[model samples]
Target: MPHLSLSDLTFTWPDGDPAFEGLDAVFGPGRTGLVGRNGAGKSTLLRLIAGDLTPDRGSVTVHGRLAYLRQDLTLDPNRTVDGVLGIDNQRKALHRIESGEGTEQDFADATGHWDVEERAVATLDRLGLAHVAPTPDALGRTVGTLSGGETMLLGLTAALLGDPEVLLLDEPTNNLDLSAKARLYAAVDQFPGIVVVVSHDRALLDRMDTIAELRRGELRMFGGNFAHYRETVEAEQEAGRAAVRDARADVRRQGRELVEAQTKIDRRLRYGKRMVAENRYPKIVGNERKSQAQASAGKLRGNHADKLDEARRTLTEAEELVRDDREIRIDLPDSVVHPGQQVVEVADLTLACGPTVSLAVTGPERIALVGRNGIGKTTLLRALTDMPPRVPWRALPQRLDVFDETRTLAQNLADAAPHATAEQIRGRLARFLFRGNDSDVLTSALSGGERLRAALAMILLAEPAPRLLMLDEPTNNLDLPSLQHLTEALAQFRGALIVASHDLPFLREIGATRWLELTDDGVREVDPR
Candidate 1:
């Protein structure tokens, strides 16, 4: 039976136009990709499928139990990975039994004769959490101490623990690092239930059995992976455009022929008139011939008009089809830079250690402080700005001026250069796409992409701009086009950049000479090229 089916579904958000209209699709016990451009209602569709939101019209039928993983999860600050995962001493005993370190009587004592503890440990191990770290009780830490990616994974583990019949994930790999993302994919691949993913990750989409593209409130199913869908869709659009061009050409040619025919008819009428004037008996015949010519000309004109209208309508339809099938646009901004190799020269820079740990960067280099979520990428950038030690970037005894994240565009400029006025800061902000009222918004409320842009705006626009610009996960929530623009801009930037990003494509585009791969094993520099 089908796992989840949406029949003639239609939905609209509170403010926007309808997102889906008469959309229909079906998922079986395998992986499927729900792909669309940014703001294409992929998230909303996932919610509907998960039964968190109901369609405004039509029916969403579920033949089996469904589980969903949202992009962001807010967990209590007091729970541990073990508590959240339902793993305890009992579970540990079961693990021992499964590993043959304990007997069946021990397992019975642990699970009250259920023997489900071993099964649970095996399941968790399969999800790639088989580390032999000390228990959280021993560490005296809660889930709140875990990294963002770890917390997100814990949520997924909870969802999977129920053993649902279907799994729905919405951009599950967004904030995860390479290793966590790999583990998530492995889990999805091994899952026994249907997997429906709403994601923009082309890599993940490669594993999908089918791709359902959402555009202009319509769903179009293709029988292959994302690459195949891309090829087929582009080909179809090209064929449509070609058809329109041919039809237009035919209409133009037919118009020219019709005009020529009319001209011939007019010439023949004149000749007949001349013949009538030469012989009075031929006058009546000439008049009849002229009338016949006029009738034929009128008929041709009417038929030509009809054909032209039909051709125009056909062209309109073809253009619409092409537009609907076209790829989404990503408008990437160019990161600006001035010549002079010394963008940032940090010598013995140490980070703060309250909410953030300390670190040192003592070189003029384009670097990346790569790590899992909440591992001080932001802290390092903040030290460059010298904000509150909530997450400070403590510079070690150096004449360092940081481009602060806590300060507004205007305020940051004033702080960076005390004499800089508000007007100058506003002008600079405008150049960075923070125009008019946008520059006034508080830094804390800004979205991830917006904050990154704003930070760049304030710094790059400043007089004697930062030689070393630091960015923290610059592409976290940015849509594709914006990312492309940033990529292009960074490619042109001559100054040093220290960016923390998991987006390999973006890193490559920005032309990082080397990458600082931060893992559980520690930080190591490698050539990512």
Candidate 2:
């Protein structure tokens, strides 16, 4: 049976435009892909279904227990990882073990009721954090000390604890490593509950049973994977185009006939006037013949006029079809420097901040930059991209890292090169999806994926396009199709791509020739094969 139903739903933000109205959807026990463009309300839908918010109209009904992994991290920082997971069962057992004040029935209820500890340990192990024990260790640690990526993983694990009938996961793999993404995929595949995931991960979408896309202000469901959904949408577009073309042809044909009939009627009327003006009493032949021709012409003209009007109306409808079916364009800038061969040359480069932190990346390579969290992957990218010194030291000149979250994308780039004028900066920003006021908005307001795109777009706009494209987590918040499109475009680009991402399938699909692996101490190149 289906686990959830959304019937005739309508919702909007306070003081903001309406998001969706008259929307109806149903989801059952299976992995479902939820996809949409930026600001299309994917997050809103998830929150509504999770019961965090109420819809202005319609109903959202859940038939069974539901668990949701929110985009924002929510966990008890004071508790240990195991303490968080073992909350329900461990408390019962520990209560019985700690206080001996209970009868046989109470002891049984507390002791053998549930194997909470075992379940907690298993869940932690599944999350690749099995080393964490239920009790405190030498390192005084709680969930608070864990990295954002680790916290996200643990929250997901906790959400998956009781095996509820439904699960709502929002970008669960956005902050994970390649191995962690695989773990998430495995967990979702084996889960018996209904799953609704809002993610931009293309590799993950390939595993779904259905694709639900929110566009403009409407939601559409397609029965298949991401690729299938696209194909179906395109097919519908083609059908709409065919209808428009047929309508146009009918209009043109009828219009020409109407013009020819009107000309014949005018000529016949003039001939009749000339005969009457001659005053030759040729009334019988001229009048009768003129009347017959006029009647014939009038009938033909009326028929053609009717067809013309009908055609005009059809043309108007066809135009509506054209406007409705056209796809929105994201206007990417053309690249400048087309290098012949060697784009970036990196030697035995070792980057380090302190004694406990260091990373390395060898040059003349197509490397996948990878690590767990709080590691120096992004730092290494900053060094490569030659971004401003947030630290005390100066970045390398040759390297260019594309992670500009400091200011408005344009302002940051303009600051990077003060010699450039506002007009030049505006031109550069336009290509990167930052046009006009978009260039003025603070970087903090931009979405993760949009920030990455803006940064890369600036790189592509560079006079001599950076030979070495050092991207720090480029696929973070991008939708599946956008990521795939980017991957395909990057494949065509003849440059050294040094990307720091945890998306394994994304890395593999992009054909990373090598990998620069980072640890707490330093970095090394590894062959995943």
Candidate 3:
């Protein structure tokens, strides 16, 4: 069985921010879901394990061969499918031998991989990429023409070809469509090696054998899949809350006891003074009795004070056990439309991808755009938002590149809604979980989830308050918490929404009123219910 281990691992970014410190964890022979907040170093940890980045200290050990699929793939546009798969050289060598131009060097280069093409085709087919593997010429097609989902599948196929014992995938489902996602899920299920995936896709995480959470520079492993992990965490949190309640009650009781003890001491002291004033006893005897009384009172006070301090400490410990997962609380009152107001109208619009879409949105309808990869979903979204409609609208594209990277998040929001005051923008940002100095952080430095949140803030805070909001794959790179926050925020939106995403669970959670599937012919309405 393949295994991966990190012993006392520590890492820090170029900016001197520590991502992980003294982290120790082990993964062996099962699918493990690596989860964390956007900046919690899930991706960084994957990079370190894949040898893309070196840890500042400690060691990373892999007991078998490893392959890693990165989140962001920067492939040359001119590279062919075969070239991207890293089998181009082998294929050329086989072709040379077949054409009677064989040389010793040719066989050496081929390395008995005469069936490499067949294996490549089979791998591509397994990944639902048979469309691009029909012929040799098809495999020669430039990568520039491939859809985002297809490119991702191609990357996966390339990784699969290696048949590594340890496989690492980071956000593998980011650009995939519904069908592609299913295929990827199947691949993951069938993989026999040790699979570690870092993703926000709940459906994918639900299939894992274990869930490893990286939080505050520590790795904690849960015994089962994401669903199991959620159940465990919820139970622990409930217990933690109960403990806090009891601790608080103890503190209050201790405080009251301390006050009562002080009151008793004061009464005793006053009585003793009166007795002395009356000369109730001989001088020496009275003095000795007074000293004893004072000592007893002091002891009682010290005991009460000690109990109170201990109670406070218990409360602090109890509070520390509870998780502080803050959610984004936002209400877009200005964005609400009238019950029957027309939000969007598309009349026989032809997209650049050859799809003709026509539709009308009224009131606060939530529409989900669904389809396979390269079926013009993103293209349709672009077409719908390209020209201004009757109502105010905003579109969040798949690429979250709407901000000026060098500027701070506050600056971007302010630029989007220039009429709004700095104080107002900051207030709105706080709702998005960007509090105080967080709002002043540069957009370039934000994590994937943080960038998405910042983009949403800018869009929702526009001057006119867009009544129609369009989002293209909004949940791609978000963490579980960020995804939950996004869902919560969208639930509060009273305007029309057209979100193109393959995350069916998220769509359902957001109360999508209608579902539309984009196709080569046009857009077809599907029953969401």
The candidate scoring highest on TM-score is 3
Q: Which stretches of candidate 3 lie over 4 Å from their true place?
A: 74-77, 100-105, 339-342
lDDT of 1 at 370: 68
lDDT of 2 at 316: 81
Write one digit per residue (lDDT tens) for candidate 1, span 239-301.
Answer: 988988987887787778778877877787787777778885566777887788788878877
**Candidate ordering by lDDT (highest first):** 3, 2, 1
The C-alpha TM-scores of every prediction are 0.73, 0.72, 0.93
Per-residue lDDT of 137 in model 2: 32
The local distance difference test score of each candidate is: 0.64, 0.68, 0.87
- Model 2, CA-based lDDT: 0.68
Badly placed stretches (over 4 Å) of model 2 are 72-115, 132-140, 143-149, 266-366, 371-469, 488-497, 503-514, 519-522, 526-529
lDDT of 3 by residue, 245-294 (tens): 99999999999999999999999899888888899978888788889999
Q: Candidate 2 vs. truth: CA RMSD?
A: 6.2
| Candidate 3 similarity to native, TM-score | 0.93
| 461-501 per-residue lDDT for model 2 (tens digits) | 55433545566666766655567677776665545567777
Best by lDDT: 3
